[model samples]
Target: MVRPVTPASAGFRARGALVAVAALVLLAGCSADGEADAGASASPSSSVSAAPSSRPDPDAPLDANQACAAMYVDGGKTLEERIGTALVGASDGLDGTSADQMHAMAMELGRLEPRVPEEFQGPLEKIRVPFLQLQEALDLADGGQVELDIASTVAGLKEYEKLC
Candidate 1:
């Protein structure tokens, strides 16, 4: 007679399988050597050094506005993660309300989305709403609203991962 696995055991096996697959995928898509990965820019003038000889160099460091577009061309890598990290970085200096911080974060995230996956184009579209709410929260300091905004951001992030 064959023994059957329980639900708990099966779930563990499934989780292990997922981890293995993710690892393989990551390994398969390693970024080119000697160049800064899409999310990690070189320095203040990183754009200038990276521009094609035919294209004019950007005057700024990382153009938050152009960030998403870069992500789109980066082969649909960790666009969501890069966006989230960039937002958190922008929010770091703020002492204002959640709305203010999240608004800033969302703007920065928007700048970064063009570089993300094609699938993320629409889901990220909805993120603007929560971001606006976040700005309002900054004025009101609604901690509850802050939590909601983060939840929405995370939800959008989950969509990005699937695109990869």
Candidate 2:
């Protein structure tokens, strides 16, 4: 006879499964074939990523953008040097919310995706509006109501995390 899984147990198992998949995708994206890697840094280009030893630890809990942000410290650069480059190569006509918008944004992400090689596109792709929301929350956080701002950002990020 098959045993039933409690929601708590099932939820934990599901989360573990997601974490494993994210790790695998992260691994597959590495190795840009070197020649391409050397070309960008030598000129004005959008290739962005943290140095390997300096990469944001892929294992940090999803809630900790702070930890990843810290990797940006130390006078170094990230795989996608700018947030726009990190999100999509060209914003061009993109603006605001729409179903197709997210995928459009993600389509441009290929050039920049390997920068944050540890992330699966699933998590990053979900950031379309939530990322905007998080930015608003972070900006608002400076108003001395930091806790509220963080709460808002976390809520948005949780929404993004749901996609993963």
For each candidate in the order shown, give its overall lDDT on alpha carbons.
0.41, 0.31
* Candidate 1 off by > 4 Å: 1-52, 56-94, 97-101, 111-118, 126-130, 139-147
Model 1 C-alpha lDDT versus the unseen true structure: 0.41
lDDT of model 1, residue 76: 49
lDDT of 1 by residue, 27-54 (tens): 3234321133444444426666564665
Error of 2 at 103 (Å): 21
**Where in model 2 is the C-alpha error above 4 Å?**
1-11, 33-36, 44-124, 127-164
Kindly list the per-residue Cα lDDT of model 2 for residues 1-164, writing each as its tens digit: 11111212121122332333234323322332132334434432332444535554544342223223322221244322332232221122223432144344334343333444354333344333333432344346442211111122223234333322
